[model samples]
Target: MSVTAPSLPAELAARRGSTVELRGLVRDFGGGVGLTGLDLAAGPGEFIALLGPSGCGKTTALRALAGLERVDGGSILVDGRDVTGEPASRRDLGMVFQSYSLFPHLDSAQNVEFGLRMRKVPAAERRRRAAEALELVGLGGHGARYAHQLSGGQQQRVALARALVTEPRVLLLDEPLSALDAKVRVQLRDEIRRIQTELGITTFFVTHDQEEALAVADRVAVMRAGAIEQIGSPEELYHRPATAFVAEFVGLTNRVPGMVAGGVLSLLGAPVPLAAPSADGPVTAYVRPEDVLLAAEGVPATVLTTSFLGAVRRTRVRLEDGTELAVQHGTREHPAPGERVGVALAPTPVTVAPAV
Candidate 1:
């Protein structure tokens, strides 16, 4: 894609972006809390999403990097230069929060231009840049509308415009689309990804929604208990999860009891390759719903329920051992509830952790 013209004034173009790194970052919050020597980095212009459940330190880590929170240890570096002591104002980053945070009295254009105005940018240049930023967010003609005058999604676009107007080196997104409706959330999410790609600015997106993280990020950092459990591409995390937590958190995984003897997990009368080497013993095998198939000759199971999901149907089946697993297949062929059927495991690789 061709590079768009500069959205900010000429002098600010050089401040575009730099690689970001966090090393041995530590924060204390009294009782065995805060980021515990967390380490992560983002390549120049790479989009990394910090994903996890609430209180998982994803937000805290984002805040620390934004200079909103102080770290008890480690350093924050931008462009290979340490900026651990820099204030938020000096970080050259833009942040969009969950809330719209738009000025009620200010119109869309003025709101987008607010940051520029604070920096004493010439009024005419600020207007031009604000218009450009609004256009970039697909709100070109709505600059005259106020927060109350715009829809939730539109307001978010304005918030994004305001954040991008100054052309910061890094964009920090903190659940910017969580407040919108499901459809709007998806639409805005795609739009955000598009805009980020267009600008090619390094972005750190903090989100608790697994789908959102998987949909937009170049790499996903799954955090647990103030530390990164795993970091990889979405496909890598989904298809080859590194741990039980990651396998369970990123997507649905059916936990079925199995024997881990001979470096394999014996589940559903079939031996599946283990994700990693585990001592021979009983284990809980993790399998995706799509990997479980209905076969004419296999382990006996009873169909508990079937949900019609447009092109695909999700069937819940209970094995003789009372283990319930979900299976997804075409809606055209579905088993009725209470029907006795044979279930088999697909050839897809499975991950197994010690049964607790």
Candidate 2:
């Protein structure tokens, strides 16, 4: 599968928040600004990821959408309806935080039923809904367990059940899996996607993990400072990054500083043609690690390092100028660091971003 990058549109803000549009949403706390005129959108049932570094306003956006953080300007909308001034209790939204946010005093079933109970649903119906929500998260038999009796993943599952039980109009997640273990995180990642697909609820997930976002989200919005850097499908963001930041952040990439002339790009004095977009200018081309193949006949270099990653081996090589690049190969012929090597790509289109 290939990943496409974002392209500069004729109307930059034309499609802003067409789904879950945020118009000039700004938030500031004392002297520190949390968000600045942020505009974002998510299609119905589309899993959108607000991805960025810590304190880059991803969580702030999710919080603002959940009515936890008040926007100083602009408005918030769900399915094109304004919910900017609506209180959290009045907004038809469900949220899962970085912390599980479960009531330690309540049992698993009780935690999931908390919202239903608050809404004054019939006891029989609330019990039925709580059980169904728990089953949705694969926590079926642990209904009576207290928070202390469940595993971290189980508690988070309970939290997921709680957020989902209300069947809210929109779903917001603030690094909900950040607190889980690696294995559990991967397990729940699939679970969250499955549950979201089953319910078809509009979701905005906040996370600093690129792999998680890329693996879980239909589209990812890479954020910088308080603004969105680029927004596109996982494939688009990975293979066709519009900026150097997205290229470097989305996947394992080897960024070689070079210049493009004509339709061919020259790297370390070698002639190379890109895959898709045609650019004839001075630019830097991006090559993914897996894209770098150890061809039978290519430029010779020395391997700096090699790491085994399950089926593929990631090898780092240094050019004649001591410049280094990484490639993942399938052959088990391990090369020691500093050993002579040769590398080239499979002649696929490459993404280029202007040098900084």
Candidate 3:
């Protein structure tokens, strides 16, 4: 699934990425919350992913930026110019969706040329740009194929070509790879990231898939209740989560009961550092499965189940105190159910919330 970078024409290459700012955006859908004082900023050529659960206002914020949804408050700015009240047609943005949205009758080249045609671009230049766009997506000779003539992945490439042919100031992707199978999703996501990097286009991607967001974006903005819960690089968000919500949402986290005293947490007979300042008291420590290991010398537990997950294996064990923990280790360390094992917590810093 390697994609060779395609060379762009001088005119296309000369385009610089634009800065985008969404300041205190508020979108209310009557009884439902769309957005709540949401604010985000993106530098030129930066890729920011809006990630969260369904109904978390990620899509609403994206639509507002694209002028597809009206905002009740706040302003939208691109390259320092206010465009809050501008129509979608005047936004100079490119967007791709989960659905390919290609015209049924039009071939790949015609579909890619649709945007140029809408702007009344000359037919000769439109054909040249369309051909180049298709080439850019690694479908150089597939321009004559129709929607039915292409696979899901190829159709998506054509849709992407159409979106990019306009050389937009900003690119908006709303779960564009959700419909594909697992392998295709991974392949297309990588290709999308590579193409975006080469083009240096400012992008805002909206998706509920954490892995997808973590893999492609320069920064991930995790949304909750119509606002950004946390925004940071993938490593920062995963390794040093600012809050319990982020730790539990960004990855697989085990809620283990522990006592926090003198800025240290005692979990499974191990002293672990706290990632953030917490009041000294009982708390539910958020620990990643990878941070737990099946050590020979630690708290005794009985293995309840084990599951193999490709490169790693996870085993669930119940402690003598009845506390269940998931330990992730190498596949070679397989432990059968009903077997007694010792579980130990790694010395990694952990995020904790008030004891429930």
Candidate 4:
């Protein structure tokens, strides 16, 4: 949000298919490192989301890749060309931020053409490109409306149109949906995905909302501290996280201390089979809330709280040994807070991490 507008270059950039490659890229801005040696390669026309909690270097990585932040180490290559030393103006990238900083004086068409004009694109060519961009965003008739005259969603679409009008090789989106409401956010998120796929331009998106990232991106890169913890498709990251940080960060997890010996793991002093058999000793069993299936043939747990959550009910149950687990069920079998119930895992993705 603190990004200042850079001086625009005066030349039209022909859009090209570009493969963005970041290898061991590091950036430090006085207060420790912003990004450690990180490596991620995004194919041409691929939509990748940089997902992580706050201060995890997602934004920092984005800025570096966009040429807004200087890289202190490693190289950044676009379309197989090493462009790490390129300035922000030199990088053929169109970026959208959480805040839509639309010009108050310029209408939708002019706003979309602003970048083209700054690049010294011919006035006639700019208009054609602007109209095309507005059409791409489903705002064809609103081209004459000023920013203040449009709705919030329309204004945001104008911003998208402006970014797309530039015809940049690569597009970068940084938490653009965070500024919108829940309903509007979902609507706009889907619209953005549609536009991206239509354009088939390589893109990098940054967001902390796992659901949003998983729903829209071709691949999700989960970051921790100043490093990338894991990067994979939505299904891969959700079903098979490479580390405990990713499992806990990407989704809701019920972590319980356990010890594994041979193929059977002991949880709360009861033997339970894990999805994978691992070496013996102390470990943490990570069971998702949805995985905690309540059945008559499972371990008994005392329900501490039951919350009716529409199609599903969330019940926090306390084991006899003082361990608490959350069980998510689809049926309306509402158990009282202090009632005892049975719990087990479902047939979906089940994983357990080593105990720290």
Candidate 4 lDDT, tens digit per residue, 1-356?
11122222223222335798899988887886588898999987899999998989999999998898888899999988888998988888999988899999989999999999999999999998888778777777778999889878788889988988888889999999898888888888888887777667899999999999999999999998788898999988887777778889888888888887776777655666676667888888777888777887777888888888888888899877788888888756888877778876665544677777
lDDT of residue 65 for candidate 1:
94
Candidate 4 accuracy as TM-score: 0.91
Whole-model Cα lDDT of every candidate shown, in order: 0.89, 0.81, 0.92, 0.83
Q: Model 1, which residues run further than 4 Å from truth?
A: 1-17
> Compared with the true structure, what per-residue lDDT tens digits does model 1 show for residues 166-231?
888899999898899998899888888887876778999999999999999999999998999999
Worst-scoring 10-residue span by lDDT in model 4: 1-10
lDDT of 3 by residue, 1-356 (tens): 55677787677777779999999999989989899999999999999999999999999999999999999999999999999999999999999998999999999999999999999999999999999999888899999999999999999999999999999999999999999999989999998998898889999999999999999999999999889999999999999998888999998999999998988788876789889888889999999999998888878999999999999999999999888888889999989999998888888999999898
Question: On lDDT, who's better, 1 or 4?
Answer: 1
Candidate 4, residue 17: Cα displacement in angstroms equals: 4.0
Give TM per candidate. Answer: 0.95, 0.90, 0.98, 0.91
Q: Candidate 2: lDDT over CA atoms?
A: 0.81
Candidate that would win on lDDT: 3
In the range 1-356, model 2's lDDT, one tens digit per residue, is 11122222222212222257788889887677588889886777789999988878888888888888888998988877898999999887889888887888899999999999999999998998898778778877789999999988888889988998887877888898988889889888888887776667788999999989999898899988788989999889888887777778888888877677666777656666664555666776788888777865766888888888888888899878766789888867688987777776655567776666
What is the full ranking by lDDT, best candidate first?
3, 1, 4, 2
Worst 10 residues of 1 by lDDT: 1-10
Show the colliding residue pairs in model 4. Answer: 283-355
> Candidate 3 regions off by >4 Å?
1-3
